[model samples]
Target: MLLLTAVACLLNTVVAAGGLQSCLHTRLSPASTLVSPSSAEYPNATVSNNLSWQYFASAVVFVGSAEDAAIAVKCAAASKIPVTPRGGRHSYASFGSGGRNGSFVVDVTRLQSFSYDPKTTYATVGAGFRLGNLALALDAHGRATPHGTCTFVGIGGHATCGGYGLTSRLWGLLVDQIVRVTAVTAAGDVVEASPSKHSDLLWAISGAAPSFAVVLSFTIRTYPQPASTSYFDFDFGNFSDTPSLAVKALLAFQSFAATSAPPELGTQFTVGRSAGGTLGLRLSGVYYGVETAIPTVIQPLLDAIPFSPISNTSKLQGYMASVAFLGGDDPVNTTGRVESPNTAYEKSIIVPTSAPLSEETWTKFVEFAFNTPVPPGISSYYWQIDAFGGSYRGKRTAMAAFPSDANAFGGRDGLLLMQHGTYSDTSGSYPAGGHAFANSFAGTITETVRTEGKKIEAYQCYVDPLLSADEAHALYFGHEKTHKLKALKHKWDPARVFDYPHAF
Candidate 1:
């Protein structure tokens, strides 16, 4: 959300004091306070889930409630400062911190409130609550909702940007679960957007929220926990070294997922190099059904692949156990967040079921993944594709069983969401070719598809900071959606107060 200042933010100490005092003067709730650049807490306030854009914020107001959020926004506007709403602080491009200095951040992570209604099966979660905590809290009542695997991701941005959970195939994207949202608009109005109220605003906030408002809370629908699941893991060690075999296996997996995979299955394919530079591919997923049925479903697909798995296994797990297993850790932290921030660059591509990745695209994917050599100053790199598989043979719904016009989320027809990322060895620094290295995959895909008279998209959740505003908006949301969003943006934020690069 970096404002287009070609140079860095001006560091006039007066600007900080003026903005901080303006909000504090409003008498924020007892628990709310503003942290200035001079404060000892400034460093922590400027950080989110990523280290790449740990820019110096002009001030951060840790809002305790929706009222506090409104006050922070109004105060920032009065002081002529930009507002960046900080939730779990996990904007890969650091939109939570504006990706630049002089950002007046409304830190909402302190407003951790949760309440559930057993009678209605609805959960009203404060925007501050992390996904992990939400999972645990809902599990206590034997209820759950769709969300990302990363526990620390805030429900606000996650839902706003098409949150894709492991259970999304069975349920739907997190945005589909959002029945209501309470927010502070550009004009400092405390409002609630829902199906029955502010309906248009509700549609915008459901996906492109940052372009319009600072969402304070979300009321979402929840479901009963899964009775049982079979967590399957398949390893094809160093298989990518042989492009032909890897391509064949990858195509087999993709074919099974796109054609015959059931709604209960959630699978991801990952190809990366080992410590010794051995390229390999791994396939893992969760089948939200009886454990014994695993072989009935996955076994045939495994047999179809040209490259045999080095080892394959499946384990029975209940709802919470399976979530923890796939997430790499139990979402447990009593005092603070669970984090290991990285100096990373990210890119994404959304593969639709309508046109599937063609032979040219798959061949290019194999080439980029295996034949490409690691560049200098890159600590780690890998690309993983999550197939949002469902019953998609034209008889049922699309991704997550939602219609294309369901909300602002543009990937409703996606069969796969591909993430290309590279981590720098040193914090806050990226190699010269780092951007190009990760961009190559999606870049090549776009080129191949265009020649065939088709267009492609990238997953908005995995934000690519390098793309121009127009390009990002167009790819993430199509020309039609972009125009619609821009019109809505003009209506809601005519002054462009809630401004960000690539935000409509």
Candidate 2:
């Protein structure tokens, strides 16, 4: 029923208006810049990476402009080589790992650019633009987009994989604002996908992996700047002792946030390493308007588990500055950057909004995440859940292609359950052993969650390889939607030019 046709694309020399020669040129005059594998800068270029905690590509091609990227993609096609687009590489999955298949790495760093059309209220951004840079750019214009807390994370890939962050409760999703995308299709054609043109391609790109093509730029809808943004933090040492309290707190806050939380207020939850050796459970947020109304909105959550007020720096700063605080000032700035030389695998699940959260599942999850013995440098994470529902609750357009029950995703107004197991060091003698350990831990968690009668639909880019095809389908597209996705794959990338490890 599926056709994996390998169509041969014909290269051409039609230069775009006043640009450089196309990839079909025989003389191959070097453009403004080119970092080849044999060049002196190759070693350094190949090793560069954002935080995702792994190394991947053996060779890296740092593309400077869309034209340069177009050339690279064309060259790869001509040479019969595979290509992987590189952004922040922040995912924990092997999605960007190129592996040993000799996939040419196309790094979009040189494509970083951000500009706005005030009249239209849109931000035309380069594929390489990180949330931090974009936030700074947007702040200059008194405009903002719902880029997540990690400032340095790439917006290109983030938008496609249904970008989310603390602000999700306020702005819906980062992808919701996407108006148009300029990309090079697998067929070697430079095209634009948007609501007006190539709408289906646009649909496939959002909430989907980079299977359609290599996106060079995205033009997204922007919103007026909020009057002010606020931040809050709380720390609890032992997670297991307050199960009932935490549940009651979570439930009460969920109800309040849905009905009464000021539209200006956006909240977040995080359970991980904090300022001290203490592993903290913190609830922090941003208020788009006056901060005076936030305390009332979050009071229910606060009442559940009172702890030492580690630090509460609530202020009326620009969105960019708020992003800096949310991302925190870290050494590697791992809060939002991608991993270089991508080496690890990422896994995530969108827990249904209506799906019941059993005490058994919660207790088991907390134990595995906090009590599990993680390798020294290696780490795992659990995101804050306080930030959900707001404008993001009813974006049926976003769930258009998602095979699962839209309601299951917290009733289409669901809270996303994000988790990842990261390996910081892959060169040690215990490399295989470390992977085995993480896998075992993950299996236990998955099994336990399954035993409780819940399902996990992963972000396409974060589907775990350990899952069998059927298992992956169930985890990713829900039981019924997986088949439809396969059909989409057949309709678009029949030749599988954008294929990666199990990217069907």
Top lDDT prediction, candidate number: 1
Candidate 1's C-alpha lDDT? 0.80
Predicted candidate 1 versus true structure: per-residue lDDT over 87-115, tens digit per residue? 87888998888767667788888777889
Model 1 poorest 10 in a row by lDDT: 4-13
TM-score for predicted model 2 compared with the true structure: 0.78
- lDDT of model 1 at residue 84? 76
Off by more than 4 A, model 2: 1-33, 48-59, 97-101, 239-263, 273-279, 306-313, 330-346, 367-386, 390-413, 421-449, 460-474, 479-481
**Each model's backbone clash number:** 0, 27
Per-residue error for 27 in candidate 2, Å, reads: 6.2
Q: Which sections of candidate 1 miss by over 4 Å?
A: 1-20, 274-276, 333-335, 389-394, 397-400
Per-model TM values vs. the true structure:
0.94, 0.78
Instruction: For each candidate in the order shown, give its overall lDDT on alpha carbons.
Output: 0.80, 0.58
